[model samples]
Target chain A: MSTSQAPLIPAPGDTRRRPLVVMRSVSKMFSSGTLALSDMSLTVEGGEFVSLLGPSGCGKSTALRIIAGLGDVSTGTIDWPSSRINSKGLPEGDISFVFQEPTLMPWQTVFGNVYLPLKLRGVSKSAAREEIMNTLATVGLADFADAYPRELSGGMKMRVSIARALVTKPKLLLMDEPFAALDEITRQKLNDDVLRLWRETGITVIFVTHSVFESAYLSNRIVVMKARPGRVHADFPLKTSMSRDAHYRTSEDYRQACEKVSNMLIDAIGGEEH
Target chain B: MSDHASAFVPPKTGFFARNRDTLLRTLIPICVVIFLVLLWQFIITVNSIPQYILPGPLAVANSLYNDWGTLSPALWVTTQITMQALALALIGGVGIAIFLVQSKWIETAFYPITVILQVTPIVAIAPLILIYAPTTQVALLICAFLVAFFPILSNMVQGLKSVDHNLLNLYDLYGASRWQTLLYLKLPSSLPYFMTGLRIGGGLALIAAVVAEFAAGSAGAGSGLAFRLLESQYRLNIPRLFAALVLLSLLGVVIFAITSFISWFFLHRWHESSLKREN
Candidate 1:
């Protein structure tokens, strides 16, 4: 909002679907005197995969956290315009967050970790058993329900984290560099899984990552952000359709998209350096 | 077997091969203990040490068997005091730890006093406690409790504070209430640290119980092994003294073993400290 940078790809405007949540001129200054974000405005529409791409120290994560209601904005407001708002006034179960780390409770089994969101809402284990199993199945971890977090591989643990996030069938999913710790092969597989899940569930995803290729591969819209009091520098949609598959990953169009996004990311960081 | 030969099936090993580690772990300690006892006996015999000064292992064992009726009651008394102090320490320590961890201000306000209580010698406090307490037993219990409480409180406070920041954020994102967060996340995550405290506190409780009784100098039929130890020394019954000392040592070991078992039972499933390594 501060920069007023127009979307490089023309905004679809009134023809676009309803915006699920809109952040208007939001700024966050932590008590530690770190200006994590300044005038970061974003509008995530229903059923769109939006990736917030940036360099290190960028406040993409801070912005995501604030939107998820895990952190309070020092200034401005986030409005859930059309999604169902809970009594807490914070969309409650309608939104789920996947952290950078798997963040599973080592003491809990995969099923228990996945059951946490419902459990917090007072749902009994027996009542939520089938739903928990189904979410685990969706993440390809149906047989690992009774396995503890310590027993899982990095990829598997991240799958459990995804299962936990999706267990509630949330309308909005916020992920903060969810696969940055993973190997390249695993990250690619998970990227495919996440795209498939988003396609299937029609959940609005705001994915945060520094990886240009990943953002290009997964997002319908990419918002390249600049660091040092982070704010949006460029917002654009892919010129191609959303039906991405393994073949599409190696396609000429996808390669061009990745190149464009990569150059934009470089410019975003380079501009800040000057 | 023939059909799967090309598939690289593992060879079946003998029982000893399978259990070499277990055998070594148990047997080495037993062998060392036996060797030490024999050396102690040999030293006493060679020196022709008087029973009043340094009783032989056999003499001490004889006294242990002969004075079982008297020694057993004293052992029971000491055991009861140690256990009661440990149990009370656990409850009070955990309760206060939870309350203190609620805020940084609360922890800063109260944690130093617990450290002070811990550092102040229980032996020095026992005399003052004995004069004011309702009975010698109560004074001993207080001293033991004071000694045992700090390790648990400090460890539990640390454990509660050390919860993964991301996990806490996840809990907040889920809108988990304070109680739900504490019960489901904080408590389970703190358990390994709590177990560490329990093991340390268990041994300290026994030491404090004995030291407090010694400092209080309470003597009677109801007195603990500490009193029996003092009485035996005063009467020049060195064998009985050695026997009582042995029982105390055994009690300490038993407390350690029980605490370790409890720690293992809870943590072996997931905690890194307790997990079995492949090697």
Candidate 2:
């Protein structure tokens, strides 16, 4: 189940070029005393797309929540180098989240959903209209600003969720299997769209998914996790340097990378059962 | 090949069939009302029932037109009492709902009393209320409010409590204040339920007002339609009694229609209830 040891903690005094997020010796124990994560640690570098790949009950989502500050670490600390840029000692707001469900406000229009983070910051719609439109355009939903979520297809709704996440122009984006519920075709299409957006904006992405092929296709590094007090079991660097496109799917290198991740996942699961 | 060709052909529907579908879907209830009226007219005419005992529809209509001089003023008084009671209920019920949501202890102490009011028969309490209250109008208003207030309070409380846990967490993450959460999330989420309670409460309040008037006889120098009904019945002026009953039913229908329309107007854009009807 284990691979070569990769130091989860970032080197101290190298904070200037260190990963944007650093989680060290983190653990989460629920009120029921179930240990979801035990001494789990990970560092996500700037402008990198990393996938937390694991089976069910692997606490991958919990790890992402700890990074997002949505969940508290019971034992250790999470350090964000980006927070040093803010001088007021206030917690920074340079992170966004996209959940598994679209989670759009049912009462709000698409445009209203995208404008929510800005609105929360007391930014007027008139002041941020250009940026809102530009964000919607990037998601190819410029014409759907007035549409309600009920009127949208599953894929379209996920697109709106992505647009809302990106509208704030955050440096870090945390997504929890945002396309897991969509059809395979739609999921693949969204995967391409998200990678394109990532490349263009240089925003660091921490995506959680159980799909080996998806991890290989979309991530620079796949952080493989094992269950039952979940912790990192492998950190595999995907070596397919081919540009992510339709041709990449047909390349021999893509299949080999996917196969490698799949074998690691099987071994991790097999070890857990014993 | 022949079967496949036939599969794509559309069937032709007759004019009557199309029209019948429309009428069955839309106008059948209206037709039933007309049919019932005609049947009632036939029964009264053929039975040779005396006008004082059983007035024909035409006779009641004539009496209603002739007595408009008196009937209109009584209608105005009833309408005023009903509206004032409803308005008071709206303000008090919503204020109480807000209090209840803020403090669980207040809800625990007061919610049972609201349930008692809802389940207790209004007819049993009206006379006691009338005897104790300073004025008959006040007594009637109190009765109406008693009947009307609980629905709005109960509905709004449920609505406020039904807010999504995730949404609340999102607000917390954004550092939104309690007031902001209530204003932006709780209030908007509760509107459809509140409106539903109002519509139901409006009709119930009218019934309470009329019944209270019936039980109290007449208040002050001004009498409402209930008094006229009593006056007609005692004198055996059956046509006029029938006329008053018809007017009362019409008033009930109008109140229900207007409240429903207002609910629809506000909620038509986002709510499923209105959307289902539109489709």
Candidate 3:
């Protein structure tokens, strides 16, 4: 938790690496009069494993949706490092969203589900077969390529979903509490698998989760949000080596990092404006 | 290779156990049918009912055999009308459903007309239709079409609307065109609903055909089963009337079976409705 070194929010010259995107005072107000988000700002660098940690009604999903261009922000500007991609990452070059549920087509086979994003882009299924299969192997679901979503266990279904997200090979991947519905064992296992996947693909992941342990474990950076017109409460960077594995999970440092993030979560839920 | 041969051995399955489930499923319905027929025969004989009032099962069977020559042509006519109406309904209904789902304005404007056609009793409209149409066959087809179209339309609409929002967003995120979404997502999603509608419409189509025939029987020399039914009724040919009714009911059963087979053929692999479960 404390290496006695750099601050959580790095300075502009932190590593001579520019953020992939920057959101300054982003806010969202629903038509139903629910101000879901308010003046929340964040900066995500490419290939970083980031988690948006928050409670149930804290608009964590809303933030992720806004990023994926599925929902619009009411105020504030989301700027990309380059103007090639739109503010919401539209025209669909470099973004994939994973919903809280698997969001797979029930009728589609595992291969079919993974092939969806590519298929939508007018790529023939035959042409996309290799990439889809390789992505399936990355998620450890190669054998289930022909299996339907309903035939799969919850974990397997989520694996297929992750494969679909990765099939597109987007620069940024957005996940919204994807493992919240899973059991503890499956979730922990998936956490490890996801980290492996991130390392292998070098895709930036902005995962939203309410679990402090999950956020601490999976992310290099954690952005904490609070409810009641959702806004950023804290943004902390964890000191984790890129090679962290099963051994790192049981270490005192990981426990301390979880403890620190857990306290910030309590503050967010308690309505303390830290 | 034989070091772990146990894993490769096929799991043992008992002959009776495997077939028992299917046997029971098939057997129970057949037994119930036999029991009902026997009970019907028992009641009729016990009440000393005459053949004119209520024919026994044997009498009906005989009537079926004796009247087969006279009845087969009428059966063919009825079958033709039922099939033509069903084909027309399938086309019109599915086409309208596709049209309805294309835009909210179009759906909102024309959906009520479909509802009106569905709710109005086909029997009441049959006479009016007969008066307007050039021939009785066209009127009969229209009646059946009106009766059968709504289920397909409504179910298809529900199917199209039932597409998961996440899947839709995924399509959008990929910049898939609207037509692409419909082709790959919406149409397949609606298949189960369309099948359900087809099954319901199948029986309704037959009923509508028969009902329209009854209405049109007096207007012309309509040789459909309903005309035979009416003629037998007037001449007091009770056995022939029973034979016609039996043929009509059997046609309904056949239509039901065909539609169900169609549904099972399409959905058995993926859909829960048609999946086989372990006992």
Best by DockQ: 1
**Structure candidate 2, residue pairs in collision:** none
Provide the TM-score for each candidate, comma-separated.
Answer: 0.94, 0.86, 0.89
DockQ of each: 0.81, 0.36, 0.57
lDDT (Cα, tens digit) per residue for candidate 3, span A1-274: 3442223234466452467778899999999999999998899887678899988788989988887788778899877774366434563568888888998877779998888888777789889999998988988988999998889999999999888888887888889899989999999999999887876666788999988899998888888999987889998888754345788788887888899999999988888443
* lDDT (C-alpha) at residue A161 in model 2: 89
Better of 2 and 3 by TM-score: 3
* Per-residue lDDT of model 1, residues B213-253, tens digit only: 99999999999999999999999999999999999999999
**What docking grade does candidate 3 earn?**
medium
lDDT by residue for model 1 (A158-257), tens: 9999999999999899999999999999999999999889877778899999998999998879999998988999999876642578987888979999
**Model 2: CAPRI class:** acceptable
Cα lDDT for residue B39, model 1?
98
Query: Candidate 3: where are CA atoms >4 Å away?
Result: A1-16, A86-91, A272-274, B1-18, B31-49, B218-222, B276-279
Candidate 1 Cα misplacement greater than 4 A, ranges: A1-16, A86-88, B1-17
By TM-score, is 1 or 2 better?
A: 1
Model 1, residue A13: distance off in Å is 12
Query: Residue by residue across A1-274, what tens digits does model 2's lDDT show?
Result: 1221112212355443347888899999988898999998888777778899999999999898777667678998887766653442224667888889888777889998888778888889999899999999999999999998888999999999899889888888999998999999999999999988987787878999999888888887889999998999998667554667788888997998899999999888888965
Ranking by lDDT: 1, 3, 2
